[model samples]
Target: MKLPKRPKQHILETASYKLFSSKIPDEWIIRDITERDYGIDCYLEMVNDDNELSGDLALIQLKSKDEIEWTNKDTFTHYGVDISTTNYWYQFPIPVFIFIGDISNQKLYFNSVHYTIKRNFDQFVKQTTFPYKFKKSDLFEGKDGVFAFKFHYYYEKYRQQFENELRFFISNLQHYKDFQQLHNNLDYHLGLEDTDQIFFESMHKNFSFLCTYFNIDNPIPKLRDIKKKSREKFGNESHYELYEHDLTEWMEEYEKLTINLIVGMKSFLNGELPYWLRINPTIYNYVNNIGDDGTLPYE
Candidate 1:
């Protein structure tokens, strides 16, 4: 009697666990997420030398195959991902990797679900049946058979390129006099309300992008807190007076914090400052408007 073909999932899981654990025995830990019936199969956490958790996590989805045909040089077709699955993976809090294991060859390849979805959003909307493809080198690589599983490594690479673009933005903003003239021109052409709306919307978009990139919480609640405190402190003050005094001071403080953060990030990129120092809690106080001391609050 011919025996039934054994399910290859167990083999895939074992292979992934062994490959990941052997590479970073001390600094990384992988846990199987058996309870969830959704896209995620496992979660990986990074740890410091002392085995303390480093706050870096990634969700992984595994696919195993005996043979996967290469559709192009350095690329293989990945199929069966529905739109709902793509949407769910896109919203994951941590980075998500789809690892395809060639069970026969014991080779692994991977790609970022976040990037794949972003690249195909327009095509997805058109209901196109495009196969998801990724390059082989996209798999994690490192020295001595060890890999850097920290999501920050990938994020930092993106950030370096982003900073170059940001420099151009800052250079444009440095022309404050020109911007003011343009604002006046807009006010002459557009109504004051329209000008104000456009300016505020631009500011909102830039700050929203910054907050998301830096993993910072939205600052609107903190701004409301400052306004509330001001109202309590100066109960007899007129609304316009409060705006000129409290709101003006808050805006100035926020500007100083933004400048400091940009400068600090540049220094950190140049290896002049430690990563921890660059994103310290004290720096975050700029958003909270908590302290005025010039020195960093943490060692």
Candidate 2:
């Protein structure tokens, strides 16, 4: 009499969960879906450095294999995506990750659905079945640090409109230095000229794009005080030196703000920073406008 036995696929599925979960850092929570899973298996919610729960989440689909090839010399596929599953991925508000675990070696690999589609839109959309071929660089088991940077880099693209032109902006700032040789040398971007225009424009574009992408309800913060301080010079007009001084100071503040915000946002998704602190919204957010007296407006 043949006895009923657990299928090999079932055994591999359990092993895959164990293998993948073991690789994930303990601080991150893996929440299994309560509803029937058409595609996504679980969400990986991050735990910040303060030992607090960060509400940021990324959807994850987990798969297991007895053995997974890290490289593909032949025309074999690592995974396949069909129309129904592709549509489900597009519906997600945040990035979706697909993690395939090698149960045999207890190793893991990952692919970002968002990044993939962004780089290969035509192939992704036109194919009836998108065959995913894994490159050796797709390995994720020992590269969580790299993942932190990638998460921060691509997070904005998810919310951006199809016609968004933020990527067109470039940066090449000039500084006001005290070297005698450098002072006399004349470049077209002379005496912080590049920075004066570029910095202002960059800041404006960055803030505007951020507000539109994030759907901020309030207006951006003003540099009214900074602008006011510049006009108090001896001639009742500002010189290049004043602009240089103010720009340098503001750039330092902006640098700190950029680093801190990147840490908070990047750290939230991937838990890279050990002391990931939550940023206050008021530090970056602003009211629609202040009162005529320039005092805080009423809510």
Top model number, lDDT: 1
TM-score for each predicted model, relative to the true structure: 0.48, 0.56
- The RMSD of every model to the true structure, in order and in angstroms, is 15.0, 14.8
The residue-level lDDT of candidate 2 at 275 comes to 16
Model 1: per-residue Cα lDDT over 29-64, one tens digit each: 788776656878788776765889867677877776
Q: How does model 1 score by TM-score?
A: 0.48
lDDT of 2 by residue, 48-108 (tens): 6686895767787777778875434622255556667867887787778777777777777
Model 1 residue 48 lDDT? Answer: 65
- Residue 35 accuracy (lDDT) in model 2: 68
